[model samples]
Target: MTDSNMNSHELELLIAAWLDGRLDDEGSHALQNALRTSRAARETFRQYARLDAALHDVADTSAMLDLTKLAAACVRPSSAEQSPTRAQESSDTEGSKTERRQRPFMQQMAKGSRVKPTSRKPIASLRMTPWYAALAVGILLVAFLIRGFSVDEPGTESIADLSPSEKTINTDAFSKVSLSKPPAPVAVLSSVEGVIWADSQLEVGHAFFEGESIRLEQGEARVSVGFGAEIVADAPCSLKFLSSDRIQLHDGEIAVDVAPWAAGFTVVTEEMDVVDLGTTFTVSVEAGEKAETTVLRGVVRVHPTKIEGEPRRGLLVSEGQRMSSDGKGSFVNVPQDQDEVQKQLGRLDFGVTGPYRPVDLSNTGQGLSTGDEDLHWQVVAGPAGVFSEPQYASVCEPERGYLPNDPDVSQWISTADWRTALPNAVYTFRTEFALDGYDLATMQLFGRFLADNGIESVRVNGNPVEVQSWVDNVKYQAFGDLQFRFVNITGGLVSGRNVVEIDVRNGMMRTGHVKDPPLSPIPNPMALRVEWYAFGRQQGIAQADDGVRLWRRIRDSVPPMSMLSYAGPEI
Candidate 1:
């Protein structure tokens, strides 16, 4: 009889989407039933609905003050006095019922003389006199005109005066606003506890937004966004706050749990500005460059301007699907390996298929010939498909395919110095290899790439660090003469020099594109937490033949992580 619910944001969203426009529909009925039946959920639903209406109203009317005064009466006190019930404030309360009586949607919703949601009918009609209503409508028109939107950038809309006593949708305002140049910088949006400040002190001359994610201009932040909020950051990028939970990326990657009815938000950037949206997806922006969008659950429409020519297409990604553009399409999806990362970083309680193999360098169970050169590695975990698996990261000689300096350069990087780079995760590194300047082959394996740049932290970057990477949800195949793409990021920026130094380790390469035989039996499916410091510090390889000597030392330095997925609660 009672199932008091709503443990997270996703549940709230599910209820919201179900009751969205047709507040009188079956979904609404079910949600309302759930709310009314459970006292705890009743207030919770009311609060969420209030916030939703506020955001909807803001979106519906982004004009300026004088013009804004004419917006939906919900913003004005006078109208509030005349209207009863916050329910009427909802966008669900579309056009007047006098006209709705003739509307097909209404006719279908109504069952003859006995109309459903008759109780809601009163609120929709809670109007002032015809003259005042006319004035309100006129204001609504103007509200769409000069609302607070930037006009400094190219392609933006303009607002005109309102004459009061009109009931027009003023669709033209959308076009103007959509086509006009970007509005001048107003106060950055502060929603759901997310704020950004890029003032004089912060001289971040270059900031880009491609798919759906946020890139900081300068200062740090403490943000808390709803689930499925996407954002990206280009190279020359670093986000070290007290905590980075609930944040998305436009150029890099992030994972979020966007509950069904809950809203999904994305931050897309190109090189100078950041755009925000609500949807389920991941955003990748080239470091300081382009943007890409990948949709997992909902649609994410992005644009520097939502008008014609300036770019009108948006990536419409859905379940098992993806859409992209040259930094155009706007959709969202959680990034790869996000769940596993969360487990390792946040120490979250998670699940995994067994055969719990540890990630020690020791080759115990794995039968590897002593001093075996020429190794191979591959990633295999999809047919059963449990979590978001990362692609195989490969590392090898920098041959003609990926370098320009020397194809014979060995020990691409000073392993002795890798510990000095101080990576940001167990995943960031830079090794040195001799690669000649040549074009990439028609085929190239690309996915998630990480490195430990001779330090305590690891760097995580995916293939094809461009906006399209996020939009397409795949690595870009390059066909260029050998050069280096050393840094791979979710935001999609390739900086530094020759890329041969950071080739994927065996585990990092994809199995489907297994060009090399696996070096040895894939030891642990789990991501490793190397005591890079101790190991690299001693310049000692944990040789399998070193018997228990190496395993014991390696085991003591770090705890075992899930070999299945490379991310999860921090150990």
Candidate 2:
């Protein structure tokens, strides 16, 4: 039949026959015509191919083919097309034969259906042309018979020996098999800081699909690509995730850290393409004006967009090197601004840093564990007047001294000296700090403290923060020097003013008597020495003025064409 005259049902049958290597030349031509002219027919063919492929993986290859019954089912006239007479009676018989042939073979085989010998020839004897042979071996196997088959081995029961119920085929299995591809996530929005998207709303942990585009309006966001790469895009940036290892940056700045396994991760721009070579790099595009590529670590291949009739060229940018596009399909070397590179690098490295300052402690409070009226730190819940200077004796051994004066951290402040704070008591120290013009979602507080005895618990903004060492009952006593206990603060931090409360607990002396304790038993100090290692935003969002200045610098510093090197096309 011609493609125009073939209905969907007929086309499906032809597809099945084609998959089974049973389609005649006329049917093949018609099927090809239908597939070419009708998208629905092509989709149906694909579904059948998928179903056939799945069946090939699980279907028993040794099963016998019931060619006569299948052909009869395909050619039999429907009851609606015939009258209730002798011809109708023959049609009813044919209908019953078709019904029997449609039953699932496994169900009938399990039910021990009767079997009878068939005069039909075995599949090995059927003549297959080269086209049919190729179709059977390369494209689709004859899995259409999975639901309708018989055993043809010698000394074994034939399908004829099975009961009538076993003779039916289960064509429903074809309709049940799924053919569509599953959704794949190419990346995840791992972190968001004061972000405003131009279109749809997205939260942290949102999965990104291929070809998904995002516009960062006001803040920064980080995406963890599936293939071992990460992207940190600053505000006013637009990008499209092309795949796990590639993306298209339309405008603004983005830092990409490609793991070793994802060495070829590429960032496409309007004027160039930056291909990573196991490195961390930054790509900035000024929307139709210019594009810059800076390699922070390792190396990257910077390919300027090819201009028609011009030879393709790329530059290998090593660490501490920067390249810029002239907005005319050419690239030039620009001064590597280490300061800007470090700033972007800081934005990518959000991990905590050391010597966290007490919210109330002044910058001059380093080394001392005791808080005075000048400091905002106050005893809110525990005994007062226990604060004292930290003094470690030789018996205290290691962890005796305090961290030396450092600009990064504030002084250690305790309620009192360890010798006077030996009693079993809990001292809650409260301090307050204000968070302004900062991205609260990206803020993280990390620090280590040296207490006389141990820390009971810690709370931020009145919400309890987890202290695993305390939960595990690990002691936090500082013997001599600054063996500080680590604390990570991720939640309970809010905008504006925030409160931090540290509950310092002084355990009872190991010796029963607190007074005149043996030298072996060191005196317990009730001091709390906290050093703010790193707090708040490790890296601030790229300012608009900075971006403008960057483009201006690139424009001013563009070297003469003679000074630029054009390496041949990337291999």
Clashes (backbone N, CA, C under 3 Å), per candidate, total 146, 47
The top-ranked prediction according to lDDT is 2
Q: Which ten residues in a row have the lowest lDDT in candidate 2?
A: 157-166
Candidate 1 C-alpha error for residue 241, in Å: 19
User: What is the per-residue lDDT of model 1 for residues 1-571, given as tens digits with 9 covering 90 to 100?
Assistant: 1235435364465466744543445556556667767776777777887888766444323321112334554554563355433443444335553222212222332333434342223222311112222333334334545785222221121111222121122134444211111111101111111224332222221111111123355323322221212222223233221111222233443322232333433342432122223334444546544455444444544444323455444434443333333434333333445454334334311111100111112111123332222122222222122223433323222211121112122112212112121111123233211112211110011122211111122222333323111100011111011111112122212222222212222121111111221111111122211111101101121121122121112111211121112111111
User: Where's the lowest-lDDT run of ten residues in candidate 1?
Assistant: 529-538
Strongest candidate by TM-score: 2
Provide the TM-score for each candidate, comma-separated.
0.19, 0.33
**Model 2 bad stretches (over 4 Å):** 1-183, 350-571
List lDDT for all candidates, in order: 0.27, 0.54
Error of 1 at 71 (Å): 24
